[model samples]
Target chain A: MTPGHLRRDAALQTVLWIAVVVVANHLASAIPIRIDATGDQRFTLSQAAHDAVAHLERTLVVTAYFTADLDAPYHEHEAALRDTLDALAVAGAGRIDVQFVDPSTAERAEAAQRAGITPVTYTVRAWDRQEARSVFMGVHVGYGDRQMAVPALLSIPKMEVELVRAIRILTVDPEDRRKVALLQGHGEPNPADYPAQHPLYQLRARLGERYEVVQTVGDAPFDEDIAAVLTLAPTSPMPAATLWHLDQFLMGGGALGFFVASAQPDYQRGTTFEVRHGIGGFLGSYGLALGREVVLDRVHNEKITLPAPGGRSVQVDSPLALTTTHVERTAHAVRSLRSATFPFAAPVVVADPLPEGIQAEVWIRSGPESTARPGPIPLDPRLLVEPAASEVAGPHVLAAVATGTFPSFFQGQPPPGVRADEPLAKGRLGRLLVVGSGDAAANNVDFVLNSVEWLLEDPSLATIRARATGDGPMTPPPAETAWRWKIAVVAPQLLLGLALAWRVRRRRLA
Target chain B: MRNVRAILRRELIGSFGQPIALVALAVFLGAVALFTLWFDDVFVGGVASMRRPFAWMSVCLAVFAPAVTMRAVADERRTGTLHVLATMPVTSFQIIVAKWLAAVILVAIALGLTLTWPLALAWFGDLDPGPVLAGYLGLFLAGSAMAAVGVAASSSTESQVSAFLLAVVATGLPWLVGYALPLVPRPWLGVVNYLTFEYHFANLAVGVLDSRSIVFFASVTALGLRFATHALEQRRLA
Candidate 1:
């Protein structure tokens, strides 16, 4: 071939190769293939997600309310959520429709709010300035008339699990839902009265999505259909008949969740008064000692901004508001939860020799630098400072669960002024969750929801919901072990280098 | 095909025959081990993943890969061996492929040696081989692309230092482009991200072998080799 023709041909081949590569890459991007190598199979869709998506009888529409141009980590989170939704769509076999809505406009923001999606405020670095931007990172799932919204998609570890659980709950027939009774007659906020600012409003709404929230008024025998009962901060003491009703409910294999407080703190009055709801002795019979003292965790606690005499607000780290990471170590209900905050919490301890057949597990505890103050305690903000050396008391359990047949406190003798006609001696196999503070659920709704779910014998997606995402805090190895690893990594490489040098020298000599 | 194989064998032997090749290999391994162990504290972190080591690889290759390929064509030209090779029956494409392949093979060997990391981790605790294999694959593909750029740079310049600098700039520009992503307008952001090497490599590092990423690296390798072959042909024609 002529030199001119050869040069032209070579240039044409190069251009052709470049074009082919670009086209091939574009096509490849259009089709994605993922292989999850994680031991947890984090990238791969869980069986629950697949099963939930496959069982969809009607078209499920998922609308993600994500604002554009989010900052680091959040931007990654938005992308990860989109990718997860796409994977779910693929897994759904055309039953799932996914849409990404930028809630930038007021109308769109309002629409997101109406759909139960809340926007989170983010401080983002934009163009050499730190700008406060309200970004929406919630997902709304709708199937038929049923709909559920995930208010936040902050963590990716359990994104799929949360999405699947929401989908499952939304699609399930309303009539088939289980019954959960809320014991009332005390000063506990009514679940039916859902004021947005109410602490239990979110919890009530979340539970209502999966179960029928029934109010068990004043010692009424739990309806046979009730699966569980929740008693939140009962201010008034229960009558013997009411206690008997609760025991009989346990005898019928019902789950009981007690968010009882030993003392009720009046922040305005600057004092806490002792509270006895008459269930403390009943819980003791189940092998859990409810301490009459409030726990103060200096190490793992929250800071409260209190108004000073000079009208200045000072942020003081209060031991009374414990922010603890010491959750149940096992893969239990609290497994998925990273941490839970309990305000004015008392201490709970399992009996030295737990009641026969009853297995008690400490589900929540304070940090090592924690102490308990005997009530009636002062709610003075001045006393909320760091604890002194004398106040240190290792760690204290704030919540516990006991499972098995519980011997009733009234097994041998009934309470004073009560006529009992042959009360049941031993209760049926059941689960009882005891939290020392009613305000435990005030900070994290998932803490209470997970406990209730576990009590209901359905801990599906609980662990996944609590999974930590993105190179989660690495457990630092001991310094000595780290040194050993360094040595182990270096010694062999050095030996290999020396061997290579020796081989090269031997070749040179030859 | 026979000419390509012959050229490939010669390139490989010629590159490995020098003591500098082993030294470079040792330096690469030692740098990776030191950075991962001391700086990132992979051992102290107790994470049975090679993520920390793999994360440092792209930056490491941007510097070392050029050193490996700097002499591929520049030294040959400086030593007056390029004309002799040009007179041979082999095409410039074959020559460029051979030189690029030699550098890539060296990088692959270095990466292969780093397998001891995961193996050691497995001995100590549970190690997921999936992401490890994926991470190694990502590094290999990324290194191959860098090798291609280095070969092209070497073919363009007769001075090894100039070639090394050219190669570093060419390969390292994409990493800088990755940081410029937030500055790009919303509509063009995805396009700009797709053009960068780190975008594709990061995807692979996460164990999601998106076909686009594979095709991206493959395209980069092809583009770099194409440029090198064109450079060789121009030199011969001149």
Candidate 2:
């Protein structure tokens, strides 16, 4: 063959090979098959996500409003979001439709705003100038007549949780969702105070996704629509009538969750005030009672930043801040948690020789290396040193659950303004979940949501939400150990150089 | 297969017998350690993962890989040995594959030496071995692709310095294009992002061994090797 013809044929082959590679890569991207090797399998779709979309009765459409001209992290996040939506579409087996709309133009931006998708402004550095660019990273899902918007998807790690939750909300029948009441007459922190970081705000938001979260304030009866009642850390004593009404609510088979605190610590005053939230006595009438002491665990605990000298703060592992993995294995609510944190918790004890037909179990407890100090204990970190062997050898109950016919606190004795025959003495079958710490309901919101799901007997999605944990913070090594590790990691580079030099010298000698 | 293996053995010995290979390996390992520890503050971040090290090593291999492959074909061509080898039974494609494999082995060694970080993490904290192993796999694939680009650049040039610079610019473009994503036209954003090295490496770094990303790196390696073979063929035809 002529040299010219040979070169032309070679060029054609090169072009064809390049085209083959491009087409193969493009096809592979569309296939959406991935092997998730992370310990948590974070990249792979969770069972909950698959379940959320698998049995979709009607077509579900997920519309993602993202700006086109995004920079590094945001661009990467958008790509990840697309991949997740593609995975969901594949999981749905043609029931799920995904759409991407670039909301860069003013008209589309306004339309996106109307759809509850908001834009986050980012500062971009252009040629010799810095400009603020507003970009949209919100998602809207539509199923049947209902539509829900994930206002802003700022976190890539939490993208699956957000999308799955929105899908679940949009697809689930409105009539199927139960109602949960949060009692709020006695100075309990408001769950609606989302901006103020009220601990129960997280719980309220999560519950709002699956159930109707309503406030039951000032002698309001627990309506039949209410499947559960949660009284979160009420500081003041609940009215006699309110306590009696709760007893009646429980008698009617409504689940009750009392996240109670025995002592309220005032960080500003450096003192603790004893709280007599009447719910404690009410719970005591059942099989479980909250102890009037603050529990401290030195071994299984979390770190708190305390103000130190020289205008700085140092993080110290505070015993008052408890973290435990000693949760009930059988209960679906707490089983998925690697560890649960209950900061500044009290103790709960099951009353021995319990009432007839009542079955109670302590589902969560502090570590064996723990001490419970009776309130009003001082609020000093220095006073939290390791207790003596006699004082520190108990697994204090941090949370307990009881399910049975609960005998009413106002069984025979009616409260003021109540007729003698008004209250039912023994209630129907009910469930009661009591956590010894109010802070836990907020800090461990997943556990709270899971508990509610377990109470309602729908714990399917609990595991998926729990798996949203990106990665746990590493247990900080001691200063000496950290220094040793840093040296161990960096020193090998020098050793590699030394070995190379020796090899070079040996070769030269040979 | 035997011809490829024989060429691979010769390439490995030829590269390692010189002092530059050892220096390059040491520099690559040291650069990763310094960037991840001091720059990324892996200790302060306190997450038991090899994410930061793999991220920094992607940039390091742009320089390290070219340095390893610069003399593979360019120095032989300059010394007229490539023509002598062309007269032998082995095809230019086998030579290219062998050189690429040798560069990949060097990259593997460099990545393997940095396992101490994960080891210390596992000893002190909770280190997930799956992500670390996936990250090593990702680095190896990305470095192999870059090395193929280096071979292609070397095959086209008689000057080793020119070949190194050419490979550096070619491999460095994909890594640098990630930063310029915002400026890329909206019509071409996805294609431009897909062409980037970090875009494919990002999932693998997080332990998602994505089939698409694997295909991307494989395609890049094939394209590089094919380009090198074509360059050699063109020289012989002339």
Candidate 3:
């Protein structure tokens, strides 16, 4: 009860508290939190990290190359790195060791250069708001012999995906070569457009694990060396000869991932937003011609808006419409976009009549506000042309699945340069899918992953939204129309009266 | 009324004392930078930049609100301060209501600062304020409700670590439950998951701000506030 005792007691308490916090911080930081929200066969980053670490394939080393110096413009990039390293360390438990390397060092620079990794130079401006010069943000993730270089970790999107990929590359078998193709020729998105340093580019590096990836152009040799043909933005119109070759290739049942933006009219205007590409000749050949027009779905609009002709009156544009669906008749689907903009568009019309024995099932559609448009628009300077009232009309298909016996664009035989006879007898016994718009394929994988799952024959991945955008026909009969009363009485009466007056006028003239 | 003021002032004052509030503020700013610099190119797929900051601000709210609210009540209870407050004349309900209100106010301030994002975007290109407003409103409601869940989980626990983890679990449960249950074979999966907070939060995320989503979020906060009050009362009884 003495004063001396009280002072000592307080000091002891402070020391104990400090000790507890230090130990707690280390222990907690070590405990990797595994998130497995994706149920059934889905391995989240944490789980993947755990599995890789537990395997202890080798000394799985991970080096984080973010500069923690405050003076760096990329100082903003630190938190994500901190959180990610923390997460990785936790998942690795004791097996996977991580070192946060300040890649700004000469030794570090030399290490990165020697790793066969290019220094990802990002132009970082100063946070001071006065002098702005470019700085770089880069990170390396991997183990002893191999490592993955991540240029930057800014947006939290797919960091988990990237991390999982890195771990897989470090641990997986050497024989498992991933077959990926940046499909050649017809304006497919270039690999460079993947932002050579983007996480997607890293994804390509990881996929190089299990498949032989060939960036193929044109359909000629359909190389035996090629596993899948990745056609992003096919620049040249695929001649009918090419289509015939593709048809036969598909008949051989090779995995064909056509990320095509065949008729995205917005590209012509020097802007790429507000676009919906229609698979006209291709899908039309199948059974449906996804109207190559833009579709507007009020049900789901991106919570984005843009200015219209009259500055005061703003137009509601849905930029995030890819995944966010709003609940309204305008969107008229499983979800609606809360944001709106000129960028997100509907699928083009699937109007081409289906060839005999082909069945096309639409995997994704725009809201009731869909509109299809024609295009051969230039992709450079990406922009949607200034909209006319006519351009706004839509209800087009952006993506769909067509499966049947396909008629070869090259019906009878091979082309002049043909060498070996690739098999064509198995053409329509299986399914071939034509996506109206390829936007959902690249980048929007978070939302459109379900569509890819369905396309890949994973049938199990047909998960949500695929239950169907809705049941029953998308549109209703005239009788069920809310304005049916006006149509029944006013419209008919006016027409009849006008006809009668015209007759009377004719009789008078006689 | 006096009890609410005392609690609010204590919460507000406490938030300023530690570097926690400043850290959250800094993180918010960091998010703005990311939005301006990177998200434009990445998120919009190089098509058209968002040119507005609200959508990105909303994403920040999603990450930060849980971190802020996790320690709001749980830290108090863990440090034995909840017991001190419980002994005071203040009712548990007043305490819970005051804390929730303060958290929401703090989030709103964060969002207010983020509003400058659209202006920054506007300086460079055209922007429609309607979606920006809707996006802000969405961020506010979604953030408030998510923070309330954090507060609720915090009140129910004693350790800040557990509370932080639980807050994440609590806020994220809606996404997991809503998206996961639908994939289940159970017949009522749709209806059940639809009832989760995300089904409604997502609605507001895109700017619909449906009465149902509003009510649902309000009810969640109210329900958590009430439950927290009960937890405080239990402490008093003990």
Candidate 4:
């Protein structure tokens, strides 16, 4: 070939290559084909998530409210949420329309407020100064006239599961939804409050999505249609009549999700007080008891920011705030959960052998490297120190479930206010889920939600909602196994190097 | 195609025949394994993924790729072998492709050696092959782009040392630009990030097969090969 022909041919090949690449890129972006090789298939949408969005007969609109220009971790959460929404949009086949709304604007903020999406305040270091910025990271799903909102996307691991559950709630017929009675009037946070800082507001909103949640005060008769009753951190002792009512309700095969706190901490006062809500005798009779001591695990826990001597806040791991990834011994309700943190938790003990026809299972437990201290403990930062040798080690249960017929606490004699006409000899089949810490609901709402769904005998919702993305857990290998892994990682390269060296030596000799 | 294969076979043999090339390969593989095992602590992290090793592989290729490709064209010109090759019936494109393929194959072999990472992780814990496979794919593509840059650098220079330095700078420029991206204006940040090799490779490292990223690497390889071809033509004319 001539020089000019060679130049032209080379130029043509370059142009053709560029064109092919540009076209291929555009096509690939247009049609994304992903293979989720994760054990949980985290990247791929679960069948339940697909079915929830695919079966959308009416238009479902998902409005994501995320503040722009957030810090590192929050931005990652927003990106994951966006990716999940994109996946949902693909699975929805155009039935689901998603709009990302920046709630920094007044109009959008008001719209978010109307949809019950709240903004969380974060302390971010900006311009070399600590600044408190309120950022909105929430999602609202609307189907027809009904709507449901995830108040905060705090946990990215459960983001997809939350979106799927929200969509399922919005699509289902309201009347067919299960009913849960929230026992109130005991100084628990009101479920009707919508403030972002309110602890139980998000939990109530989430439960309201799938259940007709009714807040009933003392002496209020248990509704016949109610599938379960949720009593979260009841401060005051219930009246004898209400206690009898709860007993009768349990006798009638109703489920109970009790989130009782053994001690309540006063952060302002730097102190704690032992709480007696007067349900201990009832629980003990049912072969379950909440310890007066607080359980602390050094191995698996969360850190808290404490004011240092230098006037700057330093993060220190606290035994009071425990984070546990040990879910192996849990029931199906919490079996799929990767991790959960229980702040200010007490120990749940199986006090005695379960009665005949009764089955009890411990759902969550503290790690083996844990200690429990008698409560009314100080809430000072100094108390966050490492566990001493004197502290006890244990596998303390933090939450448990008991299911079966039971002889009531008032089996022999009725309470002072109870009527003799009430049946107490033989209780019907029932389930009682007892969680030792109310603060756990604040950290892991999934645990509370899963417990409720399990109590309602709806495993599908519990299992589907508990499914998370990524590998479930990677327990660190033993020391010997780690050494073996190191050997395995390094041996191949060494072998190759030796082989190359030998080949070179052989060639030189030849 | 036959001519290209023949040239490729000859290049492979020539590359393996050199003790320096073998030593470079050994050093590259050993460094990757050491960095992944000790510095990144894949075993301690218990991640059961090759992300750490692949990440290190990217940085390693920035150096090793240049070493391998510097001698591909520059040493041939230094030894007066290029003029002889030019007298052959095969075109310059075939010769360039053969050299490029040989470098890519070397990189693939290096990457294949790191498979023991995931295999070892699997022995101890559950290792996800999906992300590991994706990570290897990203590494291969990234290494090919680096190889193309090195070849282009080699074609532009007759001194092996100058070619190695130039290729290293070329491959390192994208990473430097990526690190400086946060300082860029917000409006142009997306475009700047898209131009970065790390940005594209990272998406694939996480098991995402984004077409835009693939396109970026492909474009880089093609541009480098085109530059090398032009350099050869200019030398021939001179």
Candidate 5:
């Protein structure tokens, strides 16, 4: 039959016409479909959108505040932002309305100001000129008390995750006090003092999604409802009262996470090798010390500086080494990052003398090619030597959790001058998570959120990796026999199997 | 229309009914599983940096696609079936569309078996499903372009072996193009990379489906099929 004769057939024409209509309809649905390798896309925003259309309540207005500098080449950023806003609309499904307002122009700024929204200032340096990028993500979700608010979303990739978190916040009653305590005193990194851009600050705020985060320090009686205590990298010597409060909390069955710097190499003050937290009497009794020197490992090095620009680098010991438990949650091990340079650091160590029942599980560790400078520490790194000379070994633990019962530094009965409100018998039992480095918890420290989540005991708030990670600019398989796996054996085996199949297919056909 | 239907039905049935093709489909499914889920344990922890899970899966699929589609036309010529096919009352467009549809069906079937990966991930975590959907869209779009390249390569050679090799080389051009791009002239190289299947797919993989990526894939596939048609015309002249 001719092509025209085939088209004249009703059934064939129907199928063809239907195919066009179906493909066009699906294409025109304007439903941006994303099917990932792992079937995570089963939960379509289209469903949520439909739901919103059915049970629509308050209208969600999203105002995007951005730089108005049209001449600048940051339009790439603006384009991405526009795409993200479009995604929010889809997710909102007729409930979320979005508007973009560029603040570079005087009129736009004046309008935004009148709306009680400030254009957050951020300076991003171009090759020549340094222009500003506005930090206004979603300044307002609602207007009145019933209004849902999204403080800001900095990047597009993380917006969906942020949107999910916002949904939980908006949905969940804000007054619910899911307890969280910020541990103070021991030379820990204070999130409140951290810069606004710091992860810890952002993390703490994110935790407020399901938690009532309260700062606890000094002689205040640690509350019972406190689910976890965040012992951020503590720098100053911890006071006895402070140690007592921590021990008591743990004894009361509360959880604690410490993002401590190990005997890190960096020197904040003086020429001391030790990272001193006043908890020596308290934590020392349990057999963990924030070691006075950095822990170095050889296993997980990406690259270290080769003394060149971009430097001939290898990933030996990174100060920002991520000691994640990827394998299995409980018994997960860490990499030996030997060349991940800390510049200088003081790491925590388990003391030689230890009481039984106390366990120290290393969260993250340093690589094999590490050394230690014990006392009268030098600021310059040239002084570091081989292990035989400097006294250190492979796989030094960077972060760890120490837990067991304890004799409070007070061995004898209660002190004579006891206040009426104070309880008798200073002795107590509880678990203590002591980290070595104080800087690890700081904003300037490792922004790897898993560490904080591990520390905070809030797995939901675990830090998502930076957006630039997928580029994998430096990572490569180890050429060394030690790091090289049985791929040599496997590759050949695969080749042999394919060859066998091909030979069999040829023989059968022949 | 009758010719296209005949070709499409024959191609789809012929491709799907073969035990070797079924086994290949299963193997591809196995690969999607390994790449999406088990690849982490394959490389020693921290060695691969396992940067983005979806990116690797797509790259691996890009390498694997031609192996499935390389025989659509090449083997027919090798077996002298093209002479019989050419004498039949069908145009090259019908043959092309039929073979292309067959390849798409084969890939779609393979993709169906791999849905278990996402199902398992959803059962495990509270991940946003859009990116995963976007990822599948990117994969299908990428795989379609690869299928077209396979057709082009297969038509150019009488030997299936040579066709397979050519298809591999052609399919791999996008990777080298994407990798070596930024090192060359910035804006020009950027455009070249943007035209590559991966450039848009990666954007889509993250759940932001820009129209440019869809258009790029469609155009590239058309170009590849057009090249195959030209190669067939050249063969006719010979």
Candidate 6:
């Protein structure tokens, strides 16, 4: 060929190669494989997600009502939500249909609201002025006649777990879904009596998404259908017969979660008083004790906004509310908890020389710079005195789980009302999770949800939540220590460059 | 392969013979440290991650890679050494590949200097080696792609400053397009966004070694080397 023809041939080859590359990129994007190099595999979908869609008997239709033109931060969440739904759709094997609708218009917005998807209002600054913009970002899923809505897309990392949870709710068989009993009639916060902002209401509402939350009177025998029992902040003692019934329930291999405090604090009065839920003796049988001491921490604490002497508010880091990142990484219930805070928390200690066949594990603890003292504790955040060097002994156990074949607390004891021909001496295998602070369950929804799932022997959903919780908050080093580290990181490179330059100049001079 | 290695060796030695390369290395290190430590607030954020440092290093390479490659071919052509290189048995492909390879090595050296950041993080807390390795992998890919583009720009221009400017624009437009996605029309949004460097860099930054991102970078590197080779052949024809 001539030189011009050869050049034309070369140019055609280049074009063809570029076309091949473009097509390859398109094909690669179409493939569903993404290697999640994170140690925790945060980006990869959990097995639970795959399983949730793998056996879809009916079409799971998901309608996402999200404004296309949202603020920058919402953009990431929208993309992640779409990606997760797309993955689920692919896993559903033609049983899932996904659609995205912009609910910007009023008619569409009204339709979305009817479907329980609400618009979130955000204020934006543009052209030297601030203006409010209302946007809809919510998901509605339907399987058969059952429907569940993820009210808002607030967290990007949490998007997958929330979507999977909604799908699980829609797909789970009605008979197979477990019932969670909230034992009441002893001054525990009831979901029915509290307002929307109450922690009990929030806890019940969050659990209601996954389980059938039922309020059972504590004075009677629990329904046999109850898979787990949760008792939160019982301010009064249970009846003798009721305690006996609880013991019998445990003897029947039921899972129990106790979130109670030995003392109750009245923040308005700036004082605390000891209160007994009458379960201390009951817990003592299982090798766990409800300590009366209130644990306070100096490190890893949250700031609470309090009314100042003036009309303004002051944010003070209160030791009474302890925030702990020291969670047990191995436990399924607590592994995904980045940090949990316990307000007016007490100690839950395992009995010395734990009972035979009973294995207990501490799931949560206070920071190293913490102290636990017996009540009545002062409720005033400002008036609490600092602990002395001798008093600063902690890393106190705030929560624990014990599992074994528990010996019946009612062993050799007769029935409270009726004479029994035979008294049960031993119980079957059971699990008991105890928390020092009732407020923790009311406050940290994830902790209670995961604990319930652990009790029910269903940890598939917890793994999904763990994938969302990528990493815990870092405890930054002291200022001087960080400065030292910075110098250590920066100095060697500078010095090496200078030394190499000097050596080169010296060789030239030689 | 032998011709490529000989050309690569010559280019590397010629690069280190000058004092400017050392100064450039120092500047890259100082800027990366400043941006990562002070601006990114890695200490304040308190996450045990080298993500911030790697991110700032990627930003630094946008300018640093071009500075390293601006003189790769431009200085030779300006000195009338292109004719000298043409007389050698080495093909234009070998010369361009060798030049690009040398620039990538310098980029790697600059990235290697920041290893102390990860070492410090690991010393302080539980640093997962997976994300750290993924981060370095991503930085190397992005930095090498930028270096390749710089070599192509240098082959087209006779002045170092002109070459640097050309390379910066060529490499930067792709990243800047990501920020302007809001302006892109709905019909062409995906196509335009796919051309952006940020779109691909972000996937790798999150510890996701995605196949699409790898393919995209490889394609960019190949296109850059091809353009540089074509420019060399044009000089031969002239």
Q: Pick the candidate with the highest DockQ.
A: 6
Instruction: Indicate the worst ten consecutive residues by lDDT in candidate 6 chain A.
Output: A418-427
lDDT of each residue in A178-256, candidate 4, tens digit only: 8999888876667577585665678887788788988887484587888898888887887888877787777678898
Cα-lDDT of candidate 1: 0.78
**Best of the two (3, 6) by TM-score:** 6
Which CAPRI tier for candidate 3?
Answer: incorrect
DockQ of 5: 0.13
Q: What DockQ, between 0 and 1, does each candidate earn?
A: 0.34, 0.40, 0.03, 0.35, 0.13, 0.43
Here, model 5's chain A TM-score works out at 0.60
TM-score of each: 0.74, 0.73, 0.45, 0.75, 0.59, 0.84
Give fnat (model 4). 0.33
TM-score of 5: 0.59
| True-structure RMSD for candidate 3 | 18.6
Q: How well is each residue in B11-100 modelled by candidate 3, as lDDT tens digits?
A: 887775555765776676676656644554212311112323444555566667777777777888778887788678987778887888
User: Per-prediction TM-score, chain A only?
Assistant: 0.76, 0.74, 0.53, 0.71, 0.60, 0.84
**Residue A475 lDDT, candidate 4, scale 0-100:** 40
- Candidate 5 Cα deviation (angstroms), residue A102: 7.6
Model 2 has a DockQ score of: 0.40
TM-score of decoy 3:
0.45
lDDT of 1 at A212: 88
What lDDT, from 0 to 1, does candidate 5 have? 0.54
